[model samples]
Target: MSDTLTIALAQINPVVGDVAGNIRLIRDARARAAAAGADLVVFGELCVCGYPPEDLVLKGAFLESCEAAVHDLAEETAEGPAMLVGAPWRVAGKLHNAALLLDHGRVAATRLKHNLPNYGVFDEARVFVAGPAPGPVAFRGIRLGVMVCEDMWYPDVAETLGESGAEILVVLNGSPFEMDKPNLRLEHARARIAETGLPLVYVNQVGGQDELVFDGSSFVLDGQGRPAAGVAPWTDAVEITRWSREPDGWCCEGALAAPVSRLENVYRALVTGLRDYVVKNGFPGVVLGLSGGIDSALCAAIAVDALGPDKVWCVMMPSPYTSADSLEDAALVAGMLGTRLDTISIEPAMAVFGSMLAPVFAGREADITEENLQSRARGLTLMGISNKFGPMVLSTGNKSEMSCGYATLYGDMCGGYAVLKDVYKTTVFALSSWRNHTRPPGCLGPGGAVMPERVIAKPPSAELKPNQTDQDSLPPYDVLDAILDCLIEGEMSVPETCAHGFDEDMVRRVWRMLDRAEYKRRQAPPGVKVSSRAFGRERRYPITNAFTRLI
Candidate 1:
């Protein structure tokens, strides 16, 4: 029997449906763990086939492929650290999210996930049958308990593992990132530890898959539910945590050291999502209209940081209403970021559009329709460039504007990806300031002043009409963002939102806009999700519903 156990947590990112590539990742991690002289290496949930594989897991051939990949990884365990990997297994004509403990070139034991999460971007129950609670696996003379991602969220799995003589709990997670989710993960793990009196090792998948970005802040907790060590979020690395048998039980041997967590968890999440979405989809770069407003400026910084200046192309599509200050600010930001900027005047298109629409709209006052024409022209021009070139168009509308339908559907909403789709206008300013002051490691952009100071200080506007400010159509951003946080994240009712010291009529108006904008949000492209209740998958609402909380 080994006196000490060294387990390596490989917090790896796996591409969805990339069976061979995922296998390569598992093998590579195994080699690293072996080199570290670790006894076992644990990977994230669904590391073999990726998480929330949507409908791909249903296909017999895909499941067979995943099954084959698991066996293949098992075969490589003869002279290396034993592997604990996640994959979909076919059991008695039912598919379950299972974890395989491979040791000595063979499958040692298996545990299926007890809790199959079915809400908020998870449809595991649709494809996988519910797995029952399983006991721990015997490994190197010690009983090791294992559970898949959602199973750790509840008490049944951990409690069952502990009662069955498990010395330690190893949790595999496909947990995606939302604002402050790392803290929440620790809180949940601590609760489980308290219930079972067993120390826990939580390992999570990293990288962006579609709109979901899994920020890997994997950690280990002592039996007293205290955090022993933590891996920094939004990073990929293999960490070794040693445990030794004590008279009371197994205890962590030495302190685990992780990188210091910064204030940019959400910002790093956005950057990761944008980078993966572009890279996985095989897009060479991204293109966005830089309006010199806070929203666009923040998006520009994120883009450059995510994909570097060479890959991000900035364009200023100015109209007759475009301010000189805005143009200067846009140029300043482009210069600071070292991104190529081109000026394409929409003045000619607006003049032609006005002439063409004038005869048919002779009796009507020049209203929002004229303003919309300029926005649509810019959208068209951006789309044309996207088609001619290969870069995806990154739409810059923030959560506040989208929540109230302040953005036009075919106009400002035209893009392949919505960069700030989940970001509120208020958070945008904070993130931009953070980027200018601090450059986190692995960012492709420069450290100081990725966003120009003037860009952050200026008032935000669309420049679609003369003397236009966002507040003209909606409430002040601070107020509007507060209302949105209540209605969306808090899921508060209209009266409840009003109780937050908001004006009743304003709350009613904002509610109506949010309800009406459902159709636009449905049409918008997938963006990085950082907030708890982002518009797309996290919060789903019927576009045609007549039921409104506002009365």
Candidate 2:
């Protein structure tokens, strides 16, 4: 038997439902692998139909198309490295997520995923039926155990493979981004290696699918279950990882991927999510209201970085409460980014709205209703741009606002996508600072200090009323964000939060606001999810529930 195998990890991005495009990617990767003298090329799970196809696989025609694509990829292996391609398979009226090995112009074997994850952001069990745990596939006299994304998370599947005389393990993943998840992947992979005593090759998908962004941090683990090498995260790369069968076992000689900072990981996640959403959804560009505040400033910078400055359109819709500093700052930021900035006064529209509503509220005091009207007027203007032009409106609300019901329903919430929907206010400030300090590679916007220093140092306000700041309605951002993290992500009860040295009244008040804001979050547009507990899919609570801290 040959004592060596050169394997290539095709950590490429795939657009969902683009069967032909995905097949092209597989073929291209195979060519590259063949040129590199690799014995096999591996791709992430469901590469043919893309990961988490979500009801698209339910259509018989879609499955048939994916099957045809698999055969085409199989035919592409006429004179090159064998390919481990993942696709949808239908057997006897049942559907499965399978890994197909193609060599010599035919499929050598197929391994069905034994375990399907049904937890947060994954509903694979609902779409794909689990197959029986089985042995490994033979590749050039090598017994290789193939595992999908979720299969390797447990001990059962790897144990089955090790017991069945499997020599090596290969894991294909479409794992999404969350803080500390990459570290967790390495930890989980090492555990599987420890159980099997087999060197492992991990391949993950890259690019964004709706709210999910898969950071392709493909890597290799030696027989001792130690980190060998890794591919860069949040980008596309195809590299041949050379592995040799040693006296002890197989060892990987691959280049180590550079570690990305936590802040860069999050920033890249946001950029990729926005890019893919705009590109995949056929939106030509994006437009947002640049209120000269930190939230809008950070969002504007993200948009320019994601879609380039030319594709970004910034609108300054100032009203009666608009200040000279805001106008100057918005213009300064836009000029720095080189994106087009348009000023549209909302005064005329607000006057009309106020007059129209005054007759209905002849005896009522002007309060939040009037404030919300200003917000709604701005929302109307931004939505109008989205309708007239092709650019999708980008909402700039952060998680802290979403948590406490500080945002208006039809007002500032009007947009096609929310860039900072899951980002906390404190993180937003930090991210702004990071961007100003360093420009991420691949960003088309100008590099230095895009966000003004004054914007970062200013007291944040919605500018809906005179002398009004966010602190007037909500607590200080540092305090509010800390409490929100405890309540939303930590899932602490009011009493539990108060026990952590937080003021009891503040904890109770924050809990009530978070609980009451469920309906608003439900209506929010999808945003990039970089946290463990995002609003839309990860955390779901009943909007009509009467449960509260008062109970």
Best by lDDT: 2
Tell me model 2's lDDT, rounded to 2 decimals.
0.90
For model 2, how does the per-residue alpha-carbon lDDT over 1-551 read when each residue is reduced to its tens digit? Answer: 77889999999999999999998888888788888999999999999988879999989999999998888778877878999988999877889999889999998898899999987788889889998896899999899999988888999999999999999999888899998899999899989988889999999999989889898989999988877878888778887788888888888898888789999999989999999999989999999999999999999999999999999999999998999999999999999999999999999998898888788999998899889999999999988888998899999999999999999988999898998998999999999999999888777777798889999999999999998899998989999999999988898888888787899888888888999999999999999999989989879999997889445
Would you estimate the TM-scores of all the predictions?
0.98, 0.98
RMSD of each: 1.4, 1.1
Residue 546 of model 2: what lDDT?
Answer: 86
- The candidate scoring highest on TM-score is 2
- Point out where model 2 deviates above 4 Å: none
TM-score of 2: 0.98
Cα-based RMSD of candidate 1: 1.4
Q: Give the clashing pairs for model 2.
A: none
Clashes of each: 0, 0
lDDT of 1: 0.87
Task: Give the distance in Å from residue 129's predicted Cα in candidate 2 to where it truly belongs.
Answer: 0.6
TM-score of 1: 0.98
